[model samples]
Target: MLLFQLAFKYTKSQLQRPSYWLAVLSFALAISLMVVSLLVISAYEKTFEKSITQLLGQIQISYLSPNISLPKVLSYLQKEKIKVAKVTSFIHQEALLVKNGKVKGVLLEGLPAFEKKASSFFLKKTLNNTAITNFSKDRYGAYVPVLLMKDMSLQLGDAFSAVVAKSMGKNDFNRKVLKFYVKGVLDFGRSDYNRRYLLTSFEALQKPLKLSKKKTSGARLWLADKVFSEELSFKIQKHFSSKLIAQHWRQWANNLLEATKSQKKMIFLVLLIILIIAAFNIMSALFILIVQKTKELSILRVAGLSVTSIYAIFSLQAVFTGLLSLTLGFALGYLWAYLFLLIQSRYFSVLSQIYKLNHLKIGLPLWDMLIIIAVVLFLVLLTAIIPVYRAGKNSLPEGLSHEL
Candidate 1:
């Protein structure tokens, strides 16, 4: 109880030092930097995760292998208790999109949603097209990406040609040139998709590619949620033959997912280093305080205070200092983060458009953040031990006769 009195008195007397205010400001900035970093990185990761989900379904079934008989797949899908929400087949093909002296290769996706005559019209309008409707009836219609429009100088109602073939060898005699009507443009926010993709309904690609009405390249399976898909994906792999490949988005967007995780971890490490440097600043402040109070501590020792009590006084001072710094830092960090988010969300919408960023979330999973903050606070408080030892180890006569 007496130790608390000395700690409070000492801290109050030391508040006149400019170094104390500097320490508070430094620690506040460091903590705020960490908080903002966590929020931005988390939001960035979530955007990419959503992009992955849209591009690749929860699970995919590929029928490329010849041994993958259709009967086994149908039977497996018919089993009860499977949490299958929807399964849609798609026609994925690599085709050459040739326009006025500019040619680019793109993945042409044929989806069932584009089955009707009015589907292309909606695709055009949604892809930032000024034109209202598509030109073709049952003929080939292609919705190119925005990247293609800029590079190829394409326009709605324009005519273009697509070469759909396995090989580039013109002498092989299997290549087919299918002319198409420019229906619209697409922008899914991912640069890869916006630059190298074209959309067509299954009907549009059927006559051009010579495929059966119901046949498709592969099927996309969506489960109720991501949690159920993992176990379901494993079950799909175990129950299905090796000839057929059953996969989830992790397998489909493996490179993207790996990159996002790595970037997040790297950002976290950088934050940790900065926070540690702040702790070091606090350590220096404590050492200076103990040195400045050395004579006062000697007087206390002369007045019947034990060495243990002296040490406890400094320890209590450190705890109080850390608590005060934390309070100030939390307030500063949240205010700064709020202002930053406001500026970013309002002024940098172009970046959001390019990157497909949704609302920025600030330090979600509040309990986990609380745990990390607690651990960091504990570590900072430990820095007091060094100064406490140095100030309390000397005898009463030695402390009283200090030169300074």
Candidate 2:
């Protein structure tokens, strides 16, 4: 009790000094910066992962032949007791489009019409939400990429011609021309996808691709849990090894995912450097405070207080400062995050055109917060140890003779 009172009195006296406030401010700044940066990066990674996986599915199953029976695959999966969140079938092909005499090659994809209550997955990649809500309603309507729309000078409801090769040979090929109306503009946030992709109904492309209603190019599978993607993919591949191949989403976007991971590591490394500097500031401030209190500590020692008790008093002061800094830092960080979200909701445009998401989300990762707390506390404790040990070791005569 006596030691704590002495520690509190000493800490209170030091509040009038600039060095004390500098230490507190340094810690607070470091904590707040780390929290915000990590949250933003984590949100980016999650959005990117969802956009890619939702478009490609966690696992994709492709047939070895030109087309496979979609019904049979679904039935087989049901019989095999495989759990799936969602499944979508699509037909993909290459075609040439002409608008106003401008020629361009594009990858044409046909998706099945979803129920009125259920929305099509492709809508997530489109700029307009109502673009091709139900392909059954508008069979000839196509979702054109923004890049292609710009290149062809197309507007919504404009008509265009698509030529698909009925048969290909070395010297020549037979082609079939079809008319399609622009219903929506696609924006996947990547120039490569937005430059050459067109989406339409499965029924529209069946005759052109020479496939029946029962056939499809491939099926995409979304799992109930992402962690089981690789395992389920392997199982599905082994089960239908002769007829179909299964691939996980990680296989499709390995490079991009790896790049995000590297980016996160780089961000953490930079923030950690700042944190280390803050720790140094803390050490310097505490050392200075100890020097200024030399005469007071000597008085306590002369009054029969043990060196160990003196050490405990300084330790208490260090802990109090650290806890106070953490509280202020977290409060400031969360306040900033809330204000950012408010701003995002009211007055926001797409922040980055290179990423898949049009909006940003702020996420609080508990594990990350815990890690930061542990690291800061550890650094503070380590920093406090050195000066406290030096003070404990000071001879009574030296402290009594020394002047502040």
Candidate 3:
């Protein structure tokens, strides 16, 4: 109890030093910036993943070998009924779309006209078109991305021909021309996907490609929730054994994930450097406090206070400073994040120009918050240790006799 009283008194005295306030402000600023940057990166990664998963199903199942028998694939799918949610087959092929004597390479995707699980954002966008009411009946009508339509100089109701390549018995290429009407145009917010992709009902490509009703390039596996994608993918692979290749959305966008991860790592490294610099400021502040309190510490020692008690006093002072800074920093950081979100949403276009993002996004993961608190506490303790040790070692007469 006596030691605790001395510790409290020392802590109060340390607060009077100008160096203490400077250290607190510096540490707070560094932490706020680091937290905001982390939140922004995390939110962007999540949004990008959601966009990709909406366009492509959570998991995709394809033939492992080059041309597996259709019956074998169906048999494996039947066996995995419990794990599968909704299985929709699709045909993906590259074709040259020609208009006005100009040709552009396009990825043609053939899916069912009426998708039962049409709640996805991409599906909603596709269905918003007013041109074609019944996609099933309009076998010749097709949907093209807005960028592709512009590149091909295609207008509503305009007709375009697609030349599809076919593989014969030998290593040969055969060409088949199919006419298609422009029914709708879409924009997926990605320039590359929008510029080279075309969407059509299953019946449109089946006849031209000479594929049976049961055969498709691949099958998309939609789970009840996006969270089950990884588990479902593993189940699918085990059920299919060697007959099929199972991949989740993460695998489909491997490059994007890798890039995001690398960028996050770099940001973390930069933040760590900032934190170290802040910690150095804390060390300097504590050292200054030690010099200022040398005489007081010596007086406390002369009044029957132990060296350990003196050490604890300075350590408690440092901890209190860190905690106070942490509290203020978190509040300011979150306020900044909320305000930025509001501003971006209100003036999205202008903000997009400034940040290269459609809007401000911030995601504060609980783990990251805990990590920040732990790091701050650790740094505070580390910076306090040396100064506390020096204060504890001061001779009673020598320290008290020194002039400020």
Candidate 4:
């Protein structure tokens, strides 16, 4: 307790020193910089995940055949007690969208009118402005991406036509033009998805494509826990008897996921190098403090204080400094994150095309962040020990004879 008191006094005394404050500020800035970078990267990764999952679900069951029995697949999943959160069926076909004589090729997605999960792809902020209605209300209504709307010069309630293919024979193909009204506009973040994707009702597309009411291209399954996607996909394929194949989104989006991870590792390496330099700066400050107090330490030694007690006092002082710096750093980092999020919310739409995110959100698991902070603190203590140990080794005569 006495040694801790002495350590506290020495730590407080150093607060008035410019060199000590410089060390603290440097370490704090490094911490805040790392926190901000990590938060932004984490946000980007989550946005990518949401965009992919919104389009593909966690797992997709597809067949090359014109259609599959959606009820049978749903029953099979129920019979197997699969951990499915939501299942949405869709029909995917290539079609040509035409407006005012301008034609563009697009991927048409036919979603069931009852699947409210399909609304996930819509940018909610624009829903009020555009008056997005349910497909159930308007069977002939279509949802077009924002980019497609711009390219085709389309507006809500505008009439358009989709030229779909209907094969009349093995070698001959026929074209069927289906008219639709623009019901809503969507923003899926990625320019590719935004440019070429369109949505309509399953029945509206099924009849036009010469498919029966019981037919669909595929079903998307949202799992209770996505970590089990690969395992569930295998089980689904095994149960389907080759008529349908299940694929997890990770299969197609692996490159994006791997890139996010690699970028995170690169950022961490750069921040670690910065942290090491800051730690060395703090070490130098503490070393200088020990040198300046040599005579004071020698007087304490003469009064019967042991070298071990001297070492403990200095270690305590370092612990206090490290803890204080970390606290200030965390406060500054979170404050900045909050301010950035608040300010960026207003302009997210302008940035969404480039960043592929409709909104910016910051999330880092608290336990993981704590573990990182602990590792940093451990490194600081390890570095602090070197100077503390050297100070403890100073002989009584060497410390006493030093010029005051």
What are the per-residue Cα lDDT tens digits for candidate 3 across 330-352? 87777777887787668665534
Candidate 3 clash pair list: none
lDDT (10s digit) by residue, model 2, range 158-257? 7788988865768888888867878766666455566787887887788655677877779988877779888888887887776888898778667867
Output the worst ten-in-a-row residue range by lDDT, candidate 2: 114-123
TM-score of each: 0.67, 0.76, 0.69, 0.83
Q: Any runs in candidate 4 off by more than 4 Å, and if so which?
A: 1-4, 65-68, 75-80, 114-119, 125-139, 295-305, 331-359, 397-404
Worst 10 residues of 4 by lDDT: 123-132
Name the lDDT value of residue 233 in candidate 2.
85
CA lDDT, every model vs. true structure: 0.71, 0.76, 0.74, 0.80
Query: What is candidate 1's lDDT per residue for 1-404, written digit by digit as tens?
Result: 78899899878876788898788678767776766666666656665666556655778777766556445665676674666666677788888888877778888888787635334222445322344254454446667767677777887667888878854356663667777777666655565666767777887778766778767777777766568776777787787657667787777557755877797678777877887778777778888888777777889888888989988888888777777776776677667777887887677765456444434556535753685478567757777778789888866677677665
Tell me the spans in candidate 2 whose CA falls farther than 4 Å from its real position.
1-16, 27-40, 66-68, 71-80, 114-139, 168-173, 207-210, 292-313, 323-364, 394-404
RMSD, candidate 3, Å = 5.7
Worst 10 residues of 3 by lDDT: 115-124
Better of 1 and 3 by TM-score: 3
CA RMSD of each candidate after superposition: 6.4, 5.1, 5.7, 3.9
Ranking by TM-score: 4, 2, 3, 1
The count of backbone overlaps in candidate 2 is 0
